[model samples]
Target: MKTRIKFSKEGNLRFVGHLDMMRYFQKANRRAELPVAYSEGFHPHQIMSFAAPLGMGLEGKAEYFDLRITEEGAATLHSAEAAERLNREMAEGIRILSFLRLPDDSPNCMSIVHAADYEILFRAVAPEDKIAGQFVDGSAYRSLTGDEERSLRAAVDELLQRKEIPVQKTGKKGNLRELDLRPMIHALRCEDNRLRCTVAQGSEANLKPELLLSALFSLDTARPFAAMPRRVVRTELYDSAGKTLESYGTIF
Candidate 1:
């Protein structure tokens, strides 16, 4: 039986790298005594594959991984039971939100993930640094006291109106290349020091929240983005056509 595990990562565990998290779950599965399938080799490893890996220091509510178990194991280890057992074995920062049994012919989660939603909570800039008089909608400005929020909202609106926003990102091989982020950003909103955005993810194209912030604020020239985004949480995942895949709130 093939199954997909939806989980969440928060707290100090956000600092854990993808490889470390993978290892942590491997150990958790062993300690939980799950009947996980193994590869046939001198150094056997569990047959499991994770979806898009979360960046270090970023939290995710919809992380996923697929694993295989024998039919007998499936009967004994139901989805809810599996989640319960794993929760007991998992550390404080990680939680198994749900376990969904997939059809034998279903594609792996990693191949299907084409986009993801993220919510970033940031600290508002001080009044002295506000771009208050910039936006087109100035009628509602006097009533608002948070200069940072207004400035950020205006910036987001401007970014959304652009034809193309090019951003430079360092690739895995250490080469930096310029890529247009406008097409990658499917949806974006900034309000009250929080940014709710959805961008392309997975093997083909991925856009990190920090990259978007860097583009919006010009982190290189303007003040660094050190004060904002106190927390970032990935809220959901989707396929190419915007079809909702397994989510954190999903129940088996």
Candidate 2:
């Protein structure tokens, strides 16, 4: 039988990378003595997969993983009990939220994942309040006075309309490639000192939340605020049709 686990990453633990988290989970599973299945052949390994890998230094309230279990007795263990047991043994920043049984025919987490919602917070070095007030107050600032802001808005709008927004591909023999960011960006808006964005996921078209922020910063000459922390929080996960497949509360 297959099981889906939902969890949260927060606090200082946000610095943990995906691969390290995987290894941690494998160790926890072993410690918990969960009857997780092993792969066939000589190099047999845990049958586990993550829905989406969160970037380093970002936090997530909703993260998911799927695992196969072998023993029917183990399958009968209550998911809630397993979650509680895991949390007791887990480190401070990582918490297992919930676990549920999944249909054997359900699609893999990687393939089914399509979108992610994130909240980004940062302090602007420029006179953000003054500039934002002008835009919100409906008093048109002189074109020359707010040229940087105007230019930034124009760039964002143009990028939104484009069929593809090319981003530099890393870790490849060819360092540069055009990635279709249009399909990835479902929504992007700024509010309350934060930029909220929902973007497509998976191999098809992936957008790094940091890249969006970088693009905005690149448009203006003002330096970002010193000693102002930038934080990212992933709020939710969705499927291709924009349906919530699993939530943080229900993720183990």
lDDT tens per residue, model 2, 216-236: 454433233223445678878
lDDT value, residue 226 of candidate 1: 47
lDDT of 1 at 2: 84
In the range 145-244, model 1's lDDT, one tens digit per residue, is: 3655566677778888999999778888999989999998999987544678999998898898888877877632223344443567898889888875
Total backbone clashes of model 2?
Answer: 4
After superposition, the stretches of candidate 2 with alpha carbons farther than 4 Å from their true spots are: 123-167, 221-228, 247-252
TM-score of 1: 0.85
**Which residue runs does candidate 1 get wrong by more than 4 Å?**
123-145, 219-226, 247-252
Error of 1 at 76 (Å): 1.9
